[model samples]
Target: MAAIDVVVPNYNYGKYLRTCVESVLNQADVAIRVLIIDNASTDDSRDIAHSLAQDERVELILRESNAGTHASFNEGIDWAQNDYFLLLFSDDFLVPGALKRATDIMEQNSAIAFCYGRDVAVHGDDPVPIMPGRTSPVAFRLHKSRAFIESFCRRAVFQIPGSSVVVRTEVQKRAGHYRTTLPHSDDYEIWLRLAMLGPVAELDAVQVGLRTHDSNRSREFAARQLEHILHTAAAAESFFNHEGGSLEDCGALRRLARQGVVGRAYWSGIAHLLRGDMEAMRLLGFAIRSSPVSAVVPPVSYLMSRPDLAGRISSFFANSARSRHIVF
Candidate 1:
């Protein structure tokens, strides 16, 4: 059985703390230890941590002052002294037997750095849909380092759920601590770093449940789509500049990431346009200015395909070639 250390970082999440901690403790077949770090929460979180610490496997770190999320993340990295490590936020939890599933893949393939799977999310107080237990044979795929990076760099989404990712302790330390500067993209850069180190494993099942309440920071970030686009691009830049130097074709990968950013921004703007989000124009402008040559093509292609789209573009840009000629 692998020894796994789960660091549960809390901040006024007392209500969900017990369930989160319980989920970690109950992960089957692993010798589990929980480090509950209460970041000077005003709620009854400290008391809850103390009560949970009654179990020998649970430990508490109570701070009189509040350190930010990145600090807690780095602290967890420092506290990780087991074969496998996970940073499970107090509001999120591991799916039953998830750790075992991740560990099985990593243990079998020593070169695998981390394993990630899907996470089913629920809004405040809503029940998390239960994931049926898997009775079938699992076909875990081990993705090649460069190949996975190529595939990953083509999309701008946060492809993996944080709660569902389990990493190797030694590699996590080698990849280094989360950057305080890259606040929004800290996970983004780190995941890229981890993938660069070795093969990446992807589990087919939901490995964690992401619960969002009123105070959920992830939702706050998601609401600002423009910021999300900029921060994601920033993450790729930081990764290539700081750590991805040794890869054989680092330059090519970096270019792909840059193009991917514009692609994401363009699509995001169109999505907003379809929803009548007035902010769509702003995002489209950002994408166009970021790379005029590549960015203009997407909108241009859409205008050529549909007269309706041409009219829409003309409404936004009166100087469009199609609308000018159509009137003449």
Candidate 2:
């Protein structure tokens, strides 16, 4: 068996598939096995996979029908026969020396079930720093299994990009496979589940190039992605209840849920306010009043409730919006 198994789940990402595959193959020091699970793409993705599979290190699995991203990922993980696993997406490229660096970190830290590095978002030649703008939950902190889950339940601080992470195969097997039902945010859900098993080690190095284009999933299905996040937050609440977490843990989970709801309401309200919709302003006001921070930020709540004031504030911010606020 190979030392590490790299799983690439592909749909209609033919344009970016070749570059991603090539990047993996270029890793010289890491003894890696590559698996391409194609979700019955109408494009030439299968042909590209077949070409890569000509190498002894690669294998390709062709699904009969279109299973979503999560299903494809699970299928690949199930077939892995290695000590470690890395899930690389079709639109992302592994930075040079990433596999070697990640392998060394995981080997040195026996207690860490997974390790991830920073991800640089690439739009053509320009590189965008993804994690520096916001604080990450998984960085600079070594967490126990339950603590990691509780923290994630409270707020997802780390941007756990798939291409940049390497996980112990046994931890994944013990935690059970990825939940296929989670169509969009399956990676986030899986990370939470893995945190229940062991600690996650993180390297401050940037090791993956996550390409951002017009056809990216987030840009294409913005509303659906938001809905998935809200649903995942709710699911985490129920999971925590059944596991019998402490009162403090439960409170943290509830806070996380409220943050998700408030965030959705706030952003949706902004979108509507930009379109000059009074009903949207009222809805946003109700959300602010219902949120945890409402009591302290009563002025914000009051302004959001009135169409005129909300419009004025929205316009003022539109002129010079420096950064987006995190409602939670």
Candidate 3:
């Protein structure tokens, strides 16, 4: 059996630590080691992690000061000794047979750098897989690097959630670790770089249970609409240059991607307005600053009252378009 190392980087997430560690241990058909790195959490994370470390398969690293999640990601990646590596957040867990499913495809295709699957959102005790009615149960696909890059640029595939992805250990080392500079979009940047080296495979089945709560770190940063917009723009610029795209192509794609950013910011501002938040104007400012043209493009008439409905309508149009990147 191939060996895999799963790294769980946590900060004040002690309450969900046990469930996260247990899920890694439960993965079958693979030799696995779980590394729990706690970043000086204030909660009972230390005691809980220590107890979980008592198991032979798990190792606990206690940090003296909070180094942040990306720092912990680099620490775990440097320490791993397995064939494959997965960085699962403390709040999420793997579904049954997830390791087997990803590993089987990776082993058979040596050129594949990484594999990812869909997620099942868990609100309470029950896990609800978000597979749509038309989704296939046993469908999977492999995309050559160039094709994947083009599709990714056009927003064909949905964002690959970091928790549900497993990358070849050596490929991670060669492609480099997550960027400490990009706090908001490091996962997206890394995925783009990895796709440049080899193919990326996708499993249609849900592999990770993504838990939603008020304390999520992502939510905290996502609310800062300007930061999100800037980071996304930076990632697109960096990826476009790295892929050796022509100047004309880069300009066109960058404009389209930034327009998407502005559309998101506009919708976010509307959401804030609906909730009676004071930051609505600030988000609107960000939208206009990012892309003045895209900011003024009125959304559908029905979207004026419900921002959620606007998102669904926008997504339908995005998926339907093939030749160009659709921004709102």
Candidate 4:
């Protein structure tokens, strides 16, 4: 059996699919199976996928019509049959030896259900840079289920990059499929569920190259902050509304997450208001709707009180990537 089963869900990203598939096909020190699931692409993606399927390690699932991302994600989850599984978007590629590094940590720590590392973004039409894994290996940072949620979800901030995360096959199977309703933040929501299963391993290394282009999903959401807020909120709701709420301190965690989202939203709103830009008022509106109590406290007062948050909102919203980076 292969060490890992990588599911590459492609749309019309023909230019990037081959590079993404080949990245895993070319990985050394680990055996991986690649499944290129094309969701009725209209571009040259089908041909490109067929050509890549020539490799014995690669297979194709060409859907006649588009069934949506969650469909592909769920299909991949159902098809995974290896020790490890990764749902890699067609726009991302792993660096050399990334699989081995991540798998090694999970193997050593039986308590860990998944592992993730850093990922650098490459712009359009560019090749994934040659990163031969991290030169100086750092110790793996392990976060218990609730602890990981506290560090990330409490602030409605996302730290894990989807491409960088590698999960245990059985654990992923148990975590269940990606939800269709959370189209924008399904990745975020799935990470939350997986963390609920066991401790998460954070490896200190750049493991994947996440390509950015006009058609990229994260870029689209960054341009629509209002919709993005709702999507992320839906993810949190999905998690707590399920059995995940049984975790210790679930109520406190939920309250803190709401406060964090509401607080930062107000701060973002204040920044935009200072510039006389009403477009960002969506942040304030969302904050008010999410938590009336938190929304009443002036954003500046919140920032002043928590000195640590002084420049977070300003810099986060300064650019699309940074803005999308905060509430993954």
Span of 10 residues, lowest total lDDT, candidate 4: 319-328
- The TM-score measured for candidate 2 stands at 0.75
Model 4 error, position 103 (Å): 0.5
RMSD of each: 7.1, 6.8, 6.8, 3.6
Top candidate when judged by lDDT against the true structure: 1
Q: Which stretches of candidate 4 lie over 4 Å from their true place?
A: 135-137, 274-276, 295-328
Candidate 3 ranges beyond 4 A from true positions: 124-137, 156-158, 223-227, 240-256, 259-311, 314-328
lDDT of 2 by residue, 213-279 (tens): 7778764664433454455555565545543254455666666655645554555566555556554
TM-score on alpha carbons, each prediction: 0.88, 0.75, 0.77, 0.89
- For 207-231, candidate 3 gives per-residue lDDT tens digits of 8888877888676775665576567
Model 2, runs deviating above 4 Å: 124-141, 156-158, 222-229, 241-328
Better of 2 and 4 by TM-score: 4
**How many clashes in each structure?**
0, 3, 0, 0
Against the true structure, candidate 1 reaches a TM-score of 0.88
Please, what is the whole-model Cα lDDT of each candidate in the order they appear? 0.82, 0.68, 0.75, 0.80
